[model samples]
Target chain A: MANLKNNRYLKLFTSTFKLSACTFGGGFVIIPLMRKKFVQELEWIEEQEMLDLTAIAQSSPGAIAVNASILVGYHVAGVLGALVTVVGTVLPPLIIISIISLFYKAFRDNPIVSMAMAGMLCGVAAVIFDVVIDMAKVVFKKKRLLPLLVLIGAFIAVRFYAVNILIIILVCGVIGAIDTVVHEKKGAEVK
Target chain B: MIYLELFWSFFQIGLFSIGGGYAAMPLIQNQVVDVHPWLTMTQFADIMTIAEMTPGPIAINGATFVGIQVAGFPGAVIATLGCIFPSCVIVMTLAYIYYRYRGLNMVQGILAGLRPAVIAMIASAGISLLIMALYGQRSLPSDLKQFDAIALFISITAFIILRKFKPHPLWVMAGSGLAGIILYTLI
Candidate 1:
């Protein structure tokens, strides 16, 4: 039993490490890739479970990748598994960023480098725009009115008022709970 | 001392940075640029580019870059830890409860509401990034002349490439950088 637990922990660490090192972009991109690894390749998790975990990961207050890693890891090997997975997942970025920081002065001073960065910033914006559109597609596909309203309202609050994000999330969560309760009550009445 | 500061700020960022990595960009900007002045806007933009290009999530990359830039490897590790700390704790708890109450409507409702707001946050970040790329520090009319046609062209071309071709983002980043060098510096 102990050996099996150890193997699971090791597997969780290595899988997440490999995924983190190989994948770029962000959590959104990594999600599908992880589904392939955890569900298809390893058969560690079912597709439905992965989807549910992903939804929970997104709703949580952190990077979806980290949250997903922890969920999968914990599911596999408990608290220790969560710790190992988080470390493995974050290690690559820490190492890579540390290397880049070593050349911080040169990267900032080089005219060519500055130009490249300037150009890449624009690229980053474009990529982000794409992400927005993609995610918006998912949200709008349901044709639900509340989510659309919250989307616009959240944008205005953040862009114009600079409202604290925590407050916004909490408020939206309350509204969602109320909306759910009301709807369920109506459904029961109809029955 | 600096390490402590890095950890705390990033911890707050992690706590409040709901939705996903892109949504955290603005919060990072506020902390690194507006609050601490550790990185200027241009530097922040460069880091964002690097964060996008590198592995792992943008939030992790951001924390690592800012941490290293401010301190060193230890700072990078601390910052990354700080960033993931919330997720580790929160996710473990959720994992325990979630399997038990997977069918709970309250949980479903909360997530449903959170999703759209997160999308909005990402949209807000994208707009800010667009402004930063296009106008630089010059938002006013007189400073608007600083706007570079070359940058605008690069943005549009990159978007088109991404939308049409759907190549990996690494390719898009490399292509844009090459274009920048050829257009801005060589010419």
Candidate 2:
């Protein structure tokens, strides 16, 4: 039992570190990878928890990868687990950026390389679309009309008006809070 | 120097722009392309691809690429760090808050709003990429049929299949690559 517990911690540390190191394209890219590891590989967390963790990860601020590591870490081994996971995740960027601090001048306007990179953006966009469709299936399955409408509203805002998203986030947050409070009060009275 | 600006800008992207990577793109475009004009639209588009392909945050990769463009190595360093700083600070703060209000409704409600916004963000990201791609192909002769329709079609088809089948995504990826090669050769 003791050895197994120790192994979990070790596993947690290594995985989180690897996640942080290899999480290219921001934290969104890690979603599938994390699912494979936590839901399929280690089976430490259930599928629902992975789903729930994604929502929780996004609703809060900061990087998705960091928040995810913290949640998965804490879920696996408590506060210390969260600490190790976060440390592992952040370490690679720290080292890379530190090295980059010295030699930043040579990289700008490298045309041949930039052109190759252009070819890859299309692939990235396609992958991001895949993630969205997956999330949409989840949210829609709940029969959550209000959320569906809100997403449509946000889409219109971005597509048509090109509105600043921060404003929309604020508006939605306020509206959601009001609804929750009103519902809670109504339930209190009805009971 | 200018690298400092790139760092602070990306750090801001990392910190405040919530949701996820897709959500981060517009905010990045606003800063690097729209606000600063540090990079042309096509150049920025290419950097985005590089960012997506690499490990770590897409925004971080963008920061590094853009920062490198504006200033070089120091610029990339500053940009990458800047992009990361916001997330580091915000996530750490949230970690504290998450423990304090693990069961709070206010937190839950805020999340509720964000859920929809996130979907929207992701959708917009896809659209933005398409717009950029079409624009890139626009200047060519009208009859050229320049878009990589095959790649787009296959990628989406593969994604839908993977989603429906609930199999290993890597298999889908491998199959898509092979399919792509065959289609290209035949064409």
Candidate 3:
């Protein structure tokens, strides 16, 4: 950590801001760009650590973009790092969206714009479909039966029953905890 | 009143919307379109499309859009801040706990259990969005009572482009926009 130069705070803020400004699509789209910036360009973080952080960010609540920023920030400079990175990450969207909001009515009423939006929704949906496939491949790989059941159960609960998402997460978390404790006991008995 | 509601609603969304940006869509739909009377179904779709094209996360873009529509600039700030507030605190706390206890079996198990469910939620969200975009009444034709052939073509074209070249999504979206302008005008 000591190899880093002073003014690391400014560096962190600007670097994340740059990434946030440049990246187009949210979520998985930013991972490679982030690896390029933080791991390759600056050497601020190790490659393996970058992967680990990405995993943690995905699993944690909130936007992947925000979570990733916080992880990188916390890693590089601690709490201050996290704060600056969050600001950096959120600033671009705030600006762009605010500007759009000013012209919201004009954008909405224009037939040409509406047509373009219709086409864009199609494209966006397709892109999200790709994301679902990518995530499924990663999540299902080498997964055991219990985890698989949780996956299906969760989908059914949310998609059909319209169950609250937080409840599902909480229930699954508890089940996972129990699974771990039981496995530990088995291991101890065997030993 | 609207400002406070915007902040409070988005804060709830921020707290519970897990997985990623897309996972927040359904919850946002429920809050903005269903519970409150902020955006209509068509408007929600448009906001999502705009959010996709914009920089930063969709969730933030959504909050900003809804906030602005409701109460202007300050509303935008409040909603955006509220949306991100929970994330900052939660992630910071998790980052601390994660580093300390990452190797523990219990923590690992929790994540493992959670990962599959998260993936499922993402899938469910994606499918529902796709359905709404492609076949939902608002997206399709009204009198003709049929799918919009142009939109269908654009979706397939975009999917193929992404599949073959694996280009950045921005390119896919940009190409789709260009096609939309051209195709929709022509037909």
Clashes of each: 0, 17, 0
Among the numbered candidates, top TM-score falls to 3
User: Model 2 over residues B1-187: C-alpha lDDT tens digits?
Assistant: 6766786778678777676666778888989998897988987776665455345655665676677668866777677667656555555555566556757998677667667776776677566654443344313346546667765666567657756776654445446545655555566
| lDDT of model 3 at position A38 | 83
Minimal lDDT window, size 10, model 1 chain A: A23-32
* Candidate 2 chain A least-lDDT 10 residues: A112-121
The global Cα lDDT (0 to 1) of model 3 is: 0.78
For model 3, the docking class works out as acceptable
iRMSD computed for candidate 3: 4.4
Q: Which ten residues in a row have the lowest lDDT in candidate 3 chain A?
A: A22-31
Model 2 misses residue B180 by how many Å? 4.5
**RMSDs, each prediction?**
5.9, 6.2, 5.7
Q: Tell me the tens digit of each residue's lDDT in model 3 across B70-168.
A: 988888889988998888898888889878886888887876777777667656655654555566543324554566688788888888887788776
Higher-ranked by DockQ: 1 or 3: 1
